[model samples]
Target chain A: MNGSVLSARTLRNLLPALSLLVLLAAIFYLQPRAISYVGFNLMLNLAIPIAFATIAQMCVITVNDLDLSIGTYVGFVACIGATLLSGGIGALPFIKDLQASGALPATLPWIMNTPLAGVLVLLMGIGVYALLGALIHLRNLPSIVVTLGMSFVWLGLSVLVLPVPGGQAPGWIKSLMTLKTPFIPFPIIAAVVIAVAAHILIMKTSYGAVLRGAGGNPKAIERAGWSLLKVKMAMFALAGFFGMLAGLSLVGLTTSGDANIALRYTLLSIAGVILGGGEFVGGRISPIGAVIGAATLTLAGSFLSFMRIPPDWQIGAQGAILIIVLALRTLIDRAEKRR
Target chain B: MNAEPGFIRRLVAKPWLWAYVAAAAVWLVTILFTGGRGGGEVLTAAFTFATFSVIVGIGQLYVVTLGPGNVDLSIPATITLAGAVATKVMDTQDGLILVGLIVALACGVAVGCFNYALIIILRIPPIIATLSSSFLIQSTAIAYGRGIRIKPPAALADFTTAQVLGMPVLALCVIALAAVMEIVLRRTVYGRWVTAIGQNMRAARLAGVNVGRTRFTAYVMSAVFAGLCGYLLSGFSGGSSLSMGEEYLLTSIALVVIGGSSVAGGYSNVPGLWGAALFLFLVVTMLNTYGFGAGLRYLSTGLIIIAVIVAASARKATR
Candidate 1:
């Protein structure tokens, strides 16, 4: 009985990777050229940003909170990186007016033109997220409602920064994202590094255990003399940090962003987390699994295109895939119970 | 906490009252900017637009009142699909209006059933299930309609757009519907069971509340309301468009929260839905009146919502 239960758990853990491989196999079988390294790079490149977003979402789920604002937050960050850090793409109209009126410096300072400024802005965003966590905790407010409202704030900020969709990413960031990695694709390396690093940080560290504990049993953590507030703030801050990374990576690849650029990421990240076997409650999460799940979701879109399905039906197919995956999990759970 | 204040104080203490207060304040601000110019027209427009939001908000409130993690995220897709199917069925014939409405409701019923199956049979979380189902439903709408924008029947359109003494007739009828729903919520056994389940599911189950059936009913009712709103909205707007239901996704959830319903569940505020819906519309109008840019408008809208939530929560805490 114990062995059977262990095997079931192992199967559950491997399901994300298995599904990813299945998708890849399907793509390869349909389009033989996709087996090449160049084709793999093309297919998986977008998965890098999605993986980062998935990790960010995993951080929030680790604390048993949902972030409806993450997509907009990422778009906001991308807008900041592209407009301000990239040295005023086309010079924002309002900023130009302000400068002409001597209300601002004629030229942006050297610091404002650098990646460091973008980093500072992203850190400030993290602070805001931490503050949100504090507010949610102190006020006993639902995270969903708070985050839903915050989504508009982020979107507004994005529009204020970029106004229009066109902007240039900083050259260095673009180069780094498109770096010619030897043999394997750059995206694959980055994804692996992200997955391993996050797995180590969250699944192996002592404080990570405490963070998960905060969600799994807040009263127990409190009894153990841990500050639930601090744990929550840390989780939210981590989410913000990863979300910013996602934005940076996305802008690096696309070289531009708009207010609505990453809106779909909100749903995609949630789906990735669930696809990777993370539960909504109980603080059960897997960093590597989430990364794999993100890759799978990205690949699923590619698989549909390869299948020559209509663009209209592709989104519905993705939804059907999600339902089918979850349904499969249900069957496995039932089988385990029957044992 | 023990001492009872005057009747006015008690009325003020009701959570739903603050939504009305906020709506009035926002309306006052907007009219003040115009020096009362076109204030009546603005209110009339607010009534017309807010009716759709209120219909959806009521459904969302019931679902939210079903406890934590229970929300119907498929509403927007259901609305879009219903509008598309209804318009296609009506085919601009006044005689087939009833058939179109029925077809719309049938779409809702099917969607609601599919959503519940994912939730109960597959044991998927309601949030994920509704979200994924919405994607499927939206795709179906896109495929079936192919972005077609067919006009509604003349009679249906006229009914939706009709006015009486500067007030929307549709709005008045909806208000009547809301009143009936409020009574059902407060006085009916089913309503109490929903509240009980939200308050404590296990306890309610032990007390023989038929939790599954009640939950099924709530989800179905929510989808049905979305369908009705879609049928009406497409007529009011002249035709159904794919993006028509997009804004309602957030508006439905936001109105419920702003209306002073407990997000944690076990509470329902029917009157507050109208107040919140009206407030939301007026806030947008107020921003537009001030000639604020879209960015600033969105920013202030977000800030105002956060402020309201904070204030409402503070009031609840004090009580």
Candidate 2:
């Protein structure tokens, strides 16, 4: 019995990496050209933004709450990163005249283009999410409803900032994201760094244990003299911070912004969390596994494209992948119980 | 004994009262802006559009009433697939209206079963299961219709648009349907089982309630209602498009919440559904009439929803 339990635990931990490796192998087999560094860069660079988004989602899931607005919020941040952070709000209709008439300088280099201004704006966005967490706790409201409502607010803000998706990502962000390393792809290095940092923060700290305890047994945490509300707010703010990272990275890659861009990330991030062995109600999550899961999902898309699947069927294929992975999880869980 | 409050106070204490009051206030504000012009026409339009919201909102309400972490995110996809299949099969033939209706309901049943199977059998969470299933359903819709917009049969379209005494016939029919459902919710054993399971699944099981079956029926019922809405909406709009069901996703959940239904489950406000639906439709119309941009409109909608939820919960807390 002890041996079976140990094996099950090991298998559960290994699934994410194993799935990723198998997928990579399949891709390598399908196209030998994809085995090189350049091909990997082309395939995995987009996974960077997805990995960030999944981490953001895992943060919220850590506190046993979900953020339905994360996708729209990311789009809003991308709008800001492209327009306001880039030193021009030229794309907005009302501000266009101000920019043209020289009333507002063509670029506010010292004031808006600086990294300080961007960081401040992203911090304010995180503050908004923290406030949302406070509201949900104070009123005893459901996170799903509150976040669903907030999605519209973010979507509206995104549109107001960049109405037609024409703003440019700042030069520094683009350069940083595309920075070449010695051997491996930049995205892989970034993913590894993110996963390691998040794992250290969440799985190797005392506060992290308190936060998870707040989700699993709030009464006990309260009895232990910790504030559940504060933990929830911190989780939400952390999620918002990562969401900002995701949006900025996405804009850096695309070099543009749109109100509706990244809207699908809401669902995609949730799938990534589950695919990484996160649970809905237990506050169970793995940061490293989630990043790997996000990369795997992104690679799955490329794999399908390499297989010549039509774009129309790709959505269905994604759905099928989610179902199959979850089905496998169920089988493993049952085996674990039987042991 | 203390004196009982007056009738007005009693009415105000009811949770569903605020939705009706809000609906009336919004309608009045819009009418005042128009200087009373087209007031009847506006009411007619509100009823017609609110009918669709009510149809799907009822289903969503049931699913939500199954407790926290229970929601049908595949509703929009289910509606789309049903509409696509029904229209493509009917092929604009008036005589095959019944056949189309059956086929749409069948699609709903299939989707509901698949969604539940993912949730129960595979042990996936309801939200994720429905969301993933929706992708599959939407892809099937795309493959089947190839983005074709098939017009409804002329007879069916005409019937859907038909009105009597300035009110839509479809609206009246749905009103009756809501009434019947209210009875089922309050008087039937199945309804009580749903309430019990939502309140406490373990306790309900010990009390001999068939928790799984009750939850299953609620989900299936929700999907079936979505199917009906798709069938009717396609006829009303004159065709079925891939994007036709898009708006219903948020609209369904919004209406259910605004209608005074408890998101925590176990409590449902049937009467409030109509009031909330009409209020939502009028809120959009009011914003459009005032010439507000889409950004402002959406912002206000989100703010207003948050305000309503706060007020509702505050009232419950105080009581």
Candidate 3:
């Protein structure tokens, strides 16, 4: 392996990240103004939520599981946070705007401003995710079917919490989203931090070895005196935790909550995970790749809007990119194996 | 396991039994609560919707039978795209209905081929491949339907309700289609090839089963059936909308799983899909008739599905 020439093994690792840079360069070429600090934030502000959601999805994928309801569950957590941030249930929602504190009487006053309630709900959501893990493992059910059913449940719950999409996030979260500095955009900083933190936990740590082993070959890991159930539960709990963060960040960005606002995240996250050099049934995954993958997709979502392409074909353009990238990866793998 | 169902034969060996039990319970509960008033109409409505689900379920059943770790999340998007394309092609012309329907089926075949290329050629995971395709399909659907207001052709409406012997003709047609599928799945050479491949891919390949081709056909069939369902749905829905086919995605999978099809592949209870679809629709109708809240309906639907999965798995694990 010459210093200047990248070997095939390293090329496969670098391909996904390099692809992201190429996309950015192309954006600069076509729309220089879109690469500006203000432009980047505005375009990628929504992407932070997706990035976190992708990480959430990646957690499950690392364990050879898929979370079909990532978006819905995140939305559920966000709605809960939104409802609590509303301060209090002022009155019955049906009677008036529900913002009207004077509409109804004799109702048990519920405090919506309590961060403690938010914590409890977060725990509850995590519990649900863990339960899904148990169900999939103990029940021998398919993760796709279980999560698909759970999505409807989470969607229904989110709707019940916020009949209409209107709520303010916690003050700190709102500030976090708004923080500005004289240097690079906050989204870049946030994306880097998330990617690095996840990489360390998933790729560098000793326990991370166990987690990967659990997915890569469960029987071997079990033979080494590790409980598959515990590892899987941890993976799912991490996924749920990250899902909540995605939802909270989304609410922070939008300053509102709609049960269905994050619906697109479901597919986006799955796509992001795969695009990031992650496998479906293997323990193979890359945290840094997942972040870049999310960013790539987030930008792809707006490619048409930025290029003045018809909004109608915007979706098709994305599919084409995904197909091309995947095909490229396959070709690379074949070439690498042949040598 | 099918070789000898000596013990636990009643449960895992036959998923149809579970569907039958569920269907019976749902009907019994519906009649008990509705007091028999409008029972016939209710049954008709439930079965009609169930027919739509059954068509989609049949496609999904085929795909899921491909093997473990394989699924097609793109069906919802395909269905939506089909509706959009077919309706736009018809452009309110009753005579062009056949043309529109054919085009819809072709799109599905195209999508299926694309999925196969992604999974087989590119070696991408089925979940990601289908999902990406879905995104593409959905965007195309959105663009195609952006400004066009759909008016489901008059002939389609008539086709949906054209009755024979006082029974909804669409329902009977769906039954016949299911029968045809059952034959193709159980009696055909292709069917046996798929089953052998699913049971053990390497062994099937060793036996010269043309595993790739069989798997490819299964996915293509899935997309085509889903496309047909979408075209019919647009007619029943009176037009296409952005989210018209979203609900069918999960429900179709649920129907097949509950019908006793193995999510891991190799085995499927074809008619059990019909029972699962019927039971699911009946449960929703029963809940509605009882004035259950929307939240309760969704919650109960989820819980029941979970319960079924749990029960089925319990039997599976014991074996």
- Where's the lowest-lDDT run of ten residues in candidate 3 chain A? A86-95
TM-score of chain B of each: 0.97, 0.96, 0.94
Better of 2 and 3 by DockQ: 2
For residues A86-149, write the lDDT of model 2, one tens digit per residue.
7643444457767788788877545444555655777899999999888987788888888888
Best by lDDT: 1
Residue B58 of model 3: what lDDT?
Answer: 88
Misplaced by over 4 Å in model 3 are A1-6, A85-113, B1-13, B164-166
- lDDT tens digits, residues A1-339, model 3? 353234766877887798788888878888899898997887778778889999999999888888888988888877866666444443224434543556455444456334666678778899889878877876657888788788878887877677778776777888998789568989988999999999999899999999988889999999999988889888999999899999989888887778888987888888788778888877999889889888888787566676788867765776777787888888878876666
Candidate 1 structure, TM-score to reference: 0.96
Assign candidate 1 its CAPRI class.
medium
Cα lDDT for residue B137, model 3? 85
lDDT by residue (B1-319, candidate 1, tens digit) is: 4455677788986888988999999999999998989999999999999999999888888888999999998999999999999999999999999999999999989998988889998897799999899989999988888858899999999999999999999999999988988887889998999999999999999999999999999999899999999899999999898888888878999998888888889987799999999998999899999898788878887887888889878888787
The complex in candidate 1 yields a DockQ of: 0.77
Residue pairs in collision within model 1: none
| Cα displacement (Å) at residue B56, model 2 | 1.3
- lDDT (tens digit, per residue) of candidate 2 on B152-189: 98888998999999999999999999898878887999
Measured with C-alpha atoms, the lDDT of residue A55 in candidate 1 is 93
Scored against the true structure, residue A237 in model 1 reaches a CA lDDT of: 93
- Per-model TM values vs. the true structure: 0.96, 0.95, 0.94
* DockQ values of all predictions: 0.77, 0.71, 0.64
